[model samples]
Target: VTLSDLDPPNAYRISGEGSGGVAGYAKGGALVRLESESADVTVLHYDVDAQIGGKLAQLGARLINSTATKLAGEFFKSFADVVSAKAEAS
Candidate 1:
């Protein structure tokens, strides 16, 4: 993942590309927004596109989407737990 853009302390967009269990390669980006003076972070958008020619022609879209969704959920769960632990420590 790479940080494509940032707006001070409130917003940012990231871009990344990789291959997964579904067969071929994919590219996507996300827009993240942060609440002021708070720990809340939201993903406003997550978009995926075929790396070859911008279409999920052969590599089933549902399968790839499901995998990405599952991974994102796991990541957020771990991330939130870490943040909570740090807050408790502080």
Candidate 2:
């Protein structure tokens, strides 16, 4: 799905491909949840996938994997930051 409805505190299945027009194009996203650990803490559980295909994948698996890894890491970092801020405000 191009857009997702990710309601936290519940597990989910995630997958997608990215636009391949760019050099570092990758498919990257995650299945994640924020579970309350206590009144002051929340835990994130996640499984993430990042893929590169078409001309991007032709660059070899190592290149694709590396690019995907970076993309996924950035994505999760940004996502977590947003979630963390939201939790703190609640």
Candidate 3:
């Protein structure tokens, strides 16, 4: 993936083309933004998109969509855990 259009402490975008095996059958991107809500809280807004082709697409939209959703959830949860740990360390 390539990281671009970055605005530190606020927003960034990540985009990339598919490469190799099952990955070669798909391409995806994400946009993530952070908005401060209060002294101790911040809100994260994200948009994700994916396009699938080849044999992978034959797996049906329901399966593919659910897998993507699960991955995204795990990603954000892991991100939050890391950030929380860093804040505590600071």
Candidate whose lDDT is highest: 3
Give a tens-digit lDDT track for model 1, residues 5-80.
Answer: 7886667777788665445567766566655444544333334332322345365677766776677667656877
lDDT of 2 by residue, 13-71 (tens): 56676585656466766677768788877676766666766666776868666666677
**Candidate 3: global Cα-lDDT?**
0.79
In every candidate, how many clashes are there? 0, 0, 0
TM-score of each: 0.65, 0.55, 0.78
> In model 1, what is the error at residue 19, expressed in angstroms?
6.3
Against the reference, the lDDT scores of all candidates come to: 0.61, 0.69, 0.79
Clashes of 3: 0
**Cα RMSD (Å) per model?**
4.7, 4.0, 2.4
Rank order (by lDDT, best first): 3, 2, 1
Can you write out model 3's per-residue Cα lDDT over 1-90, one digit (the tens) per residue? Answer: 898899999999987776558533777777889999998778787787777776777766567766776787789879988988998888
Between prediction 2 and prediction 3, the one with superior TM-score is 3
lDDT of model number 2: 0.69
